[model samples]
Target: MHIGKAIRMERIFNRDTERAIIVPLDHGTTVGPIAGLIDMRETLSHIAEGGANAVLMHKGLVPCGHRRSGPDIGLIVHLSASTTLSPFPNAKTLTGTVEDAIKLGADAVSVHVNIGDETERDMLRDLGRTASRAADWGMPVLAMVYARGPKIKDEYDPAVVAHCARVGMELGADVVKVPYTGDPETFARVTEGVCVPVVIAGGPKLDSVAGLLTMVRDSLAAGGRGLSIGRNIFQAARPYQLVRALRGIVHEGWSVEQALEGLEG
Candidate 1:
């Protein structure tokens, strides 16, 4: 890795451990307005004040007043995107390049790849080429590897999840974001198989704060580094409180009830 890229990766890991929070605002490109994110600026501030270490957003959102306004939280530029209006939502096209990300002063770059879809081959090729370029440039690549296809029975399948993570590492991703397998023991296998750090993805919005916390606690206990929560934090009644609670669980290893009390009180 280049000196710059190595430093950037170290910075990302340090931020998450030091703060243990990531507020992902990249959902606008994939799911459109869900909730909480209706006003991006307010949501960003809430997360930042709540002690999030990084914010993942697209190129446009970053410069449009959402970039570093306060203490410099790490910025991760999302390079792949597939809007909801697209005919093939799983076919994530490369909207930006690592060179562009570097020019934009991004701390890291992320890509989305659907493992079992028909466009899987093309996406893998893109990942390989991009990974090579990123390595040359010393840019850290976060691969969001999801298993979705005709053969996929359960999105939470341990074997499939492990496969997705392994594929991302093999393609040269610095970190892999994958779904939780509902059990710590099973998810541990997936994390152990991957060469790089693996963070669990916060899937669709949950019904309750406890439910969200449970997942975070389980994933972390199972050997996962942390989380890339989106809707759970943003859509919560109190975004800052939810982020703080999550940080307690991730970095401090606090129980769900204890974390909730800390945030609520």
Candidate 2:
């Protein structure tokens, strides 16, 4: 790896733990200014204070969320986007480029590829193209791969999730994010198949923090590397407190019970 890419990776992935806790703030482009995202600067300050490794967002929003005083966090510019209002919502289009991310002072760039979606071919092509460009510039590419198609049965199936993770590796992603398979045993298979780091997406906001922490515990036990959670972290009653709880789990190996203590405190 080039020194440039290594330095960038150090910014995004913790230098000590070598794992990342990333919060995606790019939802506005898809779902329209949801809660916890209304005040970009405030939200970003809280995330940085909570010790998150990085925050992912669109290129345009970078300046809006920049922090002047809080603890520093890495910036990852999302390269693809697709609005929920679109007729083909799953069909993500490249909205930014490696050069764009670089110019924006991004530490890394990410791409979304719905593996089994109807537009799988196009998404795959996009991933490959982005990876090639990132390599040329020595930028790290994180791939958010999911199995979402009309023919898919269970998206949570370990076999299917593993396949999605592998696709990201095969196409040159430095890190891949996928939905957890619900248990440590089943989810273990997911990390086994992929050479690159695997991070779990916080699917939907769980009813309780304990439920969410338990999921994080299981994924870590199964060899997963941190999380790329959005709603569950930022939408919580206390977003910074929630991130501290998550940091305890991701970096400290705390039990679910132990992690939930911060929420109570």
Candidate 3:
């Protein structure tokens, strides 16, 4: 790794645990202003106060959510976007660039690629180009890869998830995020097949906090580096406490039960 990239990675991943808990706040660009995103600063303050490793958002949102007060968290600028209203919603297009992220003072940049989509080739091209550009600046690239599209029936299939992970590593992503394979036995295969750090994506919001933390704990046991979750964390009844629980699991090595204990008032 380039010294600069390594330095930035430290900002997002805990130096002690070599893991991260990233909260993605870029959903507004895709799905519009959702519940938790309306008050960007307050939400960011909650996340920062809860000790999240970083927050990922689009270029425009940096000014909206970047903290002026409270503890600092790493910033990852998302470079790709596809609106929910789009006819081809899975086809993500580049909305920003490495240069843009650098100017925005981002610690890293991320790209999204849906492997089974009709526009898969285009997204892969974008990922390759972005990775090369990011390398020039020694900026870390996090690839959010998913097996979603016409050909995919089960996105969480361990084989499919592993393929998604491998694609990210092959394309020079410093970190890869994919849906968890539902259990440690399967998810471990996904992580073991990739050289770069693999992080689980919080797919859809879950109704149970215990369910969420259990998933996180299982993924960690499966060798995942941590997570890049959004809705489940930001939209929780108490987002800060949720993050604190996640920190317990990701950084403090707490079991699911132990982490859940911190969630109670």
Candidate 2 residue 251 C-alpha distance from true site, Å: 0.9
Query: How do the residues 72-153 of candidate 3 rate in per-residue lDDT, one tens digit apiece?
Result: 9999999999999999999999999999999999999999999999999999999999999999999999999999999999
* Candidate number that wins on TM-score, 1 or 3: 3
| Superior candidate under TM-score, 2 versus 3 | 3
Pick the lDDT winner: 3
1-265 per-residue lDDT for model 2 (tens digits): 8888899999988788888899999999999999999999999988889889999999999999877786889999999999999999999999999999999999999999987788999999999999999999999999999999997899999899999999999999999999999999999999999888899999877888888888888898899988999998889889988899899988887777887787789
CA lDDT for candidate 2: 0.92
Clashing pairs in 1: none
Top of the candidates by TM-score: 3
In candidate 2, what residue range of length 10 has the lowest lDDT sum?
254-263
Q: Which ten residues in a row have the lowest lDDT in candidate 3?
A: 61-70
Better of 1 and 3 by lDDT: 3
Taking all chains together, the TM-score of candidate 2 against the true structure is 0.98
Stretches of model 3 off by over 4 angstroms after superposition: none
Return the lDDT, model 3, position 182: 93
lDDT tens digits, residue span 1-265, model 1: 5798878876666544632356678888888777876777788888877767777888988765364475566778988889778888889888899988898888889989999888999899888988999988889898999999888999889999999999999999988899999989999999899768888888888887888898888887777877888888888889888887877787777999998798779
- Judge candidate 3 at residue 265 and give its lDDT: 60
